[model samples]
Target: MIKGTVKIDAKICKGCELCIISCPQDGLGLAAQFNDKGYRYVELIEDNCTGCVNCALVCPEAAITVFRQPKPAKKSVEKK
Candidate 1:
């Protein structure tokens, strides 16, 4: 399976839950601490992200960035 992750710009996030709601994997959540803007920022709470870009698409501040790593290709055995 393809692995995924996200980076959130805490400084710019306005604590909107739109990204959290749009996340199919339920990987996002609000941080315990507040950002520079005094808003609780969204963060990756789980490792089940699939990099679907759903969170990024729904983010009004464009603070979320998703990265996807492709599954490794399998090696085939040679027939003698």
Candidate 2:
């Protein structure tokens, strides 16, 4: 399972809700408070993000940034 997260630039976000709708994991939501631009910004509502980049792709303002955790390394067995 790939664990991931996202960061949103609240100052520039216009509360378009495009990212929220594009998110497949339901990890994003609009903030209750407004930003300096007087628009509610997007936020991570769940910890189930997979860094799919869907939200970022749909964001017109390009305010969302997705970060994915690296996969674990596989252990190798040495031949005796």
Record all residue pairs in model 2 with backbone atoms less than 3 Å apart, i.e. clashing.
none
Query: Given candidate 1, what's the lDDT at residue 42?
Result: 90
Kindly list the per-residue Cα lDDT of model 2 for residues 1-80, writing each as its tens digit: 67888999899999999988888888888899999989988889898999899999999998888898766432222232
Please name the candidate that would achieve the greatest lDDT relative to the true structure: 1
The lDDT per prediction is: 0.88, 0.87
lDDT of 2 at 57: 96
Per-candidate total of colliding backbone pairs = 0, 0
lDDT of 2 at 32: 95
TM-score of every prediction relative to native: 0.86, 0.86
Q: Provide the global lDDT of candidate 1 against the true structure.
A: 0.88
As a TM-score, model 1 comes out at 0.86
